[model samples]
Target: MLPFALVASTLNSGLVSASSYKPRASVCNGHAELCDRSYGNVTFIGSHDSYAISATQVAANQDQNITTQLNDGVRMLQVQAHSYDGSIHLCHTSCLLLDGGLFSDYLTEVNTWVVANPNEVLSILIVNSDNLNASMYGAVFETSGLDKVSYAPTKATTSVADWPTLGSMIDSGLRVVTFMDNSADFTTVPYIIDEFSNVVEDAYNAVEDSFPCTANRSTGTPENQLVLTNHYLDQVGSSTSIVTPNKSKLNQTNAETGTGSVGQGASNCFQIYARSPNFILLDFYDAAGLAPFNVAAELNDVSAPTNTVANYTGGDGSTSTSTKSTASTTSTSSSLSGAGPQFKSEMMPLIVAVAVAVMAGSGLMLA
Candidate 1:
């Protein structure tokens, strides 16, 4: 199938899987940058960035040369994006969220693209920050009633899950995202975990609240899944199934898996979501349970199990239950204003002033 692409939009999907790349400089003869490719040991060079496109670049298809390389046996679409606009997302200012289009519209487009371009575009790569400067992005998925990808703040006093980006992604089917415990004793890289849960819930309630009623994690698989593909994303046996996650319960082996390299998970995020066997709950439990693997970069020299989208794992571990509800599939977005007003800023912005002084006098890298 001709992979589902995020085309026809006004803004270019930015550059696929890159912020550090300049087309002319990165291309070697007629190929993509060596760094931009490589999913585990699989050698990925399909559609690079599917979500973060810029208009002019979009029109030109700067990545098509590599796409041609994928002509015969393309199985994954690798995407890459930085979380913040550098100076923007950090300071407390309102700005456009990353998923630039309307959440409903965007979701609809994804479904359409998946249908239109089957098997080729399987996964999504999210190398951006969790908090965008926009609120609409946050509101639609995590907030109450909005249709855009607006940004919300990772407020000084906000709950981690309530951050605008997390809420929206979760609402949009992000199943799991567990960084290192932040306090684990393992010497792993600080990583980022983003599991795409296709359950697609209302930003207003828990995924359990919307349609089916699945239990929380620690217990076995939620009862809501056995009969359905609720949280456990992949089928019993498919090429996409993961081979060596925690260890092999099947062969009774415990040789630990390392952050071998950036594997096929990120290289196939968007394309795989199209089919049912194409999904996997995103998670980042410390193989050693030491720290959160820092997922902010594309190829961080962090540690083993480096960064993956939602690749399969070997062995049929456990399963969720089947205690569900008769729910409606209608779209319903809510607003964050209902949670009371956004926090009013307190101090007169001393941090900005201080940062400026330090940068100006110290020749700091903050610029």
Candidate 2:
């Protein structure tokens, strides 16, 4: 394998950051049914964001976790539009895809939980990961042994649980923001970075203008290859390019030469379709002004953030975090404890080293 550094190349050295889920209240049994009438404000998170818990955290919190936790929360949900006459679209796993490989996952979770000892979480999974090909819009997304999960789109508008839960959240005071379909390519997936970035930019601007709240997204533009992601990671320079399709890319833009890899002007477009579905499940909604190049540096900056922090592991994996739970919540009750203080602790020594590097290499805006 290529060196880790070379394999996962940093698209850029900058970052844009925002978003910290704030749970207004504790969830309860069968609460989704009472979503609209009594739940109050709702937040829906995709299953992918919910589960991806570190094996360690999952082992710790599995004992007393919610029966289900929404991953899309008031943020946004992604919708992918694929047209494969009879063939299947193979892509990375998505948080909201609820298909195949489900029952086993459910069974594993139950089995793991049963064996947990006090202080030992079977997994740090977000309860919402329970969604599979069964409910939660899951569908059969398979071609060969390489199978994937897909939340059913036909009945997406008729969710029996999410809507009410959203209502409940709204009643309780949560502002349901925007819906983000994991995928939104007007025509075809773009092969060029510019084409992909344009689609994402369009989607981002739409969601930002509509909801105005920070969001996690994986909405791609007719992208057969995963381009725009809604979530963030925490690898060394992870957030810099994991998602946030490069509307403000550091590379040269590709001309819509000949038959573009995507749509006529996808290479330059940066938004979603006007007729897409709303994943918000509720109503209401959220942007990056400078596309902060120093996002990560901003968050951990000794000074307050001037731009979005490094969107990396702010929540999406790539960093030490809890599964079934958001790592970078905006505001939660006092009961919620901060995660991985060690990550924060490690920052100082690194900063000291970087300080010396700066003196030797040059000076720059860490933020």
Candidate 3:
């Protein structure tokens, strides 16, 4: 039988080997500087109009399900909710246009994911089209079991300096943060953060030529609070139909690549605001080879997984697959390679220390 010290050293060595074999976790996992950096300073990939997804084109913002988006590393979900049939539901503009279903159902899925993956942090930005009070949203969260894990900021509005670190929030078990565009009554439900006071987002329906770095809704410089970059492109369609011409072009150029792309829009905003955008909202998140997620990882200086896009099964029982287009008109090839700033330099030393500890422990057991 193995001696006591030998058994413990073997178990420690086995644990280190197993963890090292796992894929690198989220960039925000380690490093106090990155984790404690103001929430406004961190960058997240956001899905614009996230609930408007269907097999058929129905004023869609995203082409896939919420679970798929989360799996692909979307940290922020932006949806419009309205009071429908006594309860709040996720809809686009109006229920007559597109209804994604009950808000509680959506929150349930999110809650399940949150509990399963304790390391991940997520945010929900709701456009309260119905002007429902904060309690209305709070009830849904409570019912869905999401409230238990929600983060309640001490202040009604969080300044750039007041934001907590991602690590701290995770450690405290308050990982899901929420914001509302309107009717966010902090007194009633503290977790329902006021969007306008904390985040400045560009116009949602801006044309490619008109997309600017100027703040439209929120006031003050980007340094004062968090900022969102709206990178979706829309064209004029009939009242009945919102024609998104050049969708392929929009998806191709909207990543964090070169200028003229919507991803470049972030760099443009950075130049004007003097701080990088915290959330980059994109339509057709899986388009152009999942460019939004790739761009987000790059902006945050993390290693992105292989550039793989989801094969979207349409709402109409049809199937459409997305592949990185080799034919890109934008400044650079739309197929972005893993060429971004790396995580904090201290990560290497940390990994080495773990390996050394395992080896030294094993040697001590032999002695």
Candidate 4:
């Protein structure tokens, strides 16, 4: 059954048509120099738990939606997946805590964006907390039409140096790269690659003010894999075990140059590993405006973008027009508005009980 489904998905998977051989992109990812650079060599600013977006939700990791993040030059997006109400959903920790939406819906938005931006390459990292089968994810991708633009490598894992240039990926129309942190079976779902096999990462869920450059989670040879630096700071949330983004530290954490800054963390990794990190993941990226992007640009040797789209202010759930500002480079501790809805200490037990009940009823094991 799985084989048949995989075959069906592949046939409908809208890989770049052979007849429509487009010319190589002159500018890839906002830079002509990056067009010729290997996709693995380029540095990209990433949003941590990109789908957990809200201006008022306590569990929200981002203030803007996925489309806004992409438009503002966030090339990589990280999402946490879990089973909820008999379907896959983008959730944080657990659905009872924070539910972004259905996985298919999320992919549809991404598909729409990828189709509209032909010259840009995007990457998505899924943290499969529920340990769902790769084909289950492949099914969602197929239904959402995201499979149309998704990239499938010839092998399960490719060395960093062997990756194609960004221009080639864009020209081929296979611009979206998908990675799964766990339970990724490439033989069944070729487009969803295993992340640890191709990428290495620094520590995550960090609470320390000082970010370390040492490898914390990696199965692949560090030298042969792309580097991903987890640069976000965390703090104890409603409970001692529950950790949330340290919102108060956003200005320093996402700054271009400072102690505990993204720049400093990336630089530390580069000095120890002898290469720039391919991805630097952050929370509330809009808090410090384009600071993360500036650090990435410096690492990539490209000029930083002059302006950025303001953080989402849509309180009604409808997509709102973002105002552009040239003053994004300056540290913006003041722009970190709305402390968000606070989680009551008394609600933690109830939330945990409900989450456990839901998981038990669905026969899904939590990670």
Candidate 5:
């Protein structure tokens, strides 16, 4: 059976019935010089655990859906693909732990966005958790019609300086660039570029104080490879299963402060590489205002508006959760509103979960 078969019947029906929403404007607009820079020179805000957005404690890493993420100016999408029952699904660690629906569904949404936004360049990083060959995953891209616009390097390895400009890529109709963390068989799927060859990233689980600017995993030095900075902090817990952090606190403090902030993260990395990072991965990028994009603009020496969009609010306009808005190519006010959770951010999720449990227990006691 196909992966979509595993989707809950009600949810599958909703997805099928919902009208296809068109994507927002391209984030790359008005930055023509960005295209002139090396691929490694560009900075992208990546979605960590891109598929984990269901809101369940074990599974939810994001507050909104994948298309919402894309529409919010996230240029790089990082996901884990696992093969289950002969079909691929986007999951975190294991499909049983966090099944994110069909891999085809994801590529289809991306394909729709890519087709609508012709000028933008998108990057995808896949963690081959199941160790499936490139062709296996490539087949999905092919079927989704993404392969038609996918970019293949002319050689085994291409340096930042040699990488085609964003405009050049768009003109050539090669808009999508793919990277695989493992099991990349370029012979079978040439577009599935091996990630380590072109990029180096810091450890994903790094805390704020010891966050090393140095490469945790890379084939070469930061000077030679594109720097991917992993800036999200995991809430300290006794176990990984209980480590989910509060999304709002993540938006305010981590996304706004010290080493976690896009400017500071870039600054910390510049100390080591003599240049800023190429990719900045965040958990809730929508809450960071214009910090990420503005930082990228500064690094690229291009003009960026000082203003940022208003911070997103939760579904009920309450602090129970948070969500982001559609992408905006233009700028708004530059002030960092510092708007976020009224309660402490980090422990909010656990608190909410615990509060519900306590209320349930109190009712049981009365009964």
Candidate 6:
């Protein structure tokens, strides 16, 4: 037997060695099987117009705030950028319709989440409605410190197969992937790469309940680019051109399996494209709770998260309390139905000017 001092020293040394031998991360995005999968190959549920959140605001595309959405397992965040008050703002159609505040503030909020959750990989898709320069967006990202964790691609365009795996991104500490729908100058800001160059998107603002899958927008080769299916249902307003989320169909639209369900849309897209959709963007995603996540899990061939958010009662009649229910409860009101802001007599001139600018340049009346 060793002396008392020697025994204590040996135990301490063993503890140090054990502590130093830290195992690498084996799980990513809540799945061990996804660690080895490429980022482009993995399916991520996205919140369309994620910044537009309000209980009473009719044009609001999302119910919960950004933090709530991220906490509930939305891996991708899609926001529309518009010029307002001489700065980039996250607005729905026109700022007069729905102003979500400054883009930098939004980025700062996202950066906070990214720093806190180091292991999670996030994707940000910016719809450059104003076609702002990449430098402008990059400046905001830099100011917010989000650029520190952002992934910069070597080239402007990358084939879906060439993207790095989730494990590699997590290990490197540079995990946030960003894309802009327009004016993504790689030479100026390589982190915010061109979206259409690497992704093909299905037509947005679906008026029909069928939710047909088609490659409506893409500059990259469809076969090699990542597939982004717009899975939200929209209803025509007083005019055929005006459209808003069909809140009445939230249950059926976001169900795992049924007509116009996210599951059906994903399966249809998979069958048509011969590959799984990389991102499925949904409006008011919390309405159906884990249904969208389950659909994504099925597409990725992985188990879905067991936690529940919003008012999702299982088919067996087992009701689970919402992780975040404040905003969702208010969203159920019948008064929440409008494509844009109610016009005011005094604000008409400014609204008309902004509307003309948006419609003439991008024709994005609906997000």
Query: Least accurate stretch of 10 residues (summed lDDT) in model 1?
Result: 54-63
lDDT of 1 by residue, 172-284 (tens): 33212222101211122111222222112111111121212122221122211111111111111132221112221211111112122112222222232221111212211
What is the TM-score of candidate 3?
0.74
RMSD of each: 23.1, 19.1, 20.2, 10.9, 14.1, 12.0
Better of 5 and 6 by lDDT: 6
lDDT of the candidates, in the order given: 0.22, 0.22, 0.63, 0.74, 0.62, 0.74
Q: How many residue pairs clash per model? A: 67, 90, 4, 0, 3, 0
Task: Give a tens-digit lDDT track for model 4, residues 1-367.
Answer: 0011122221122221222333378989988877767777788999898887656555667876676677788899999999999999988777876677899988887787788888999999999998999999999999989998999998998888777778788888998999999999978999999999999998888889688778877898987788898888887644334455677777778777779988788768766666678899987777776777877777776787776656544232223233463322211221223344445622553467456655665322111
* Ranking 2 against 5 by TM-score, winner: 5
Q: Which ten residues in a row have the lowest lDDT in candidate 6?
A: 1-10
TM-score comparison, 2 vs 4, better candidate: 4
Which digits, one per residue and each the tens of the lDDT, describe model 2 over residues 64-139?
1112222111222222222223322211132112111232333233323222211111111111221221212222
Q: Say what the RMSD of model 3 is.
A: 20.2
Q: Estimate each model's TM-score.
A: 0.21, 0.23, 0.74, 0.81, 0.75, 0.81
Itemize residue pairs with steric clashes in candidate 5. 306-334, 307-333, 307-334
**Full-model lDDT, candidate 2:** 0.22
User: Taking the tens digit of each residue's C-alpha lDDT, what string does model 3 give over 1-367?
Assistant: 1011222222222221211122223335333334544455567878887767643343456766676667666789998899998889986555654567899988887787788777667899998987999998999999999999999998887766567666667767888999998889888999999998888887766656445768878844545777887777666533322334235455444444654565567667666665557788877666655556655555554466464566543222222234543221111111111222134321332234335446655311000
Any residue pairs clashing in model 6, and if so which? none
Candidate 1's C-alpha runs over 4 A off are: 1-41, 46-49, 52-100, 117-121, 132-367
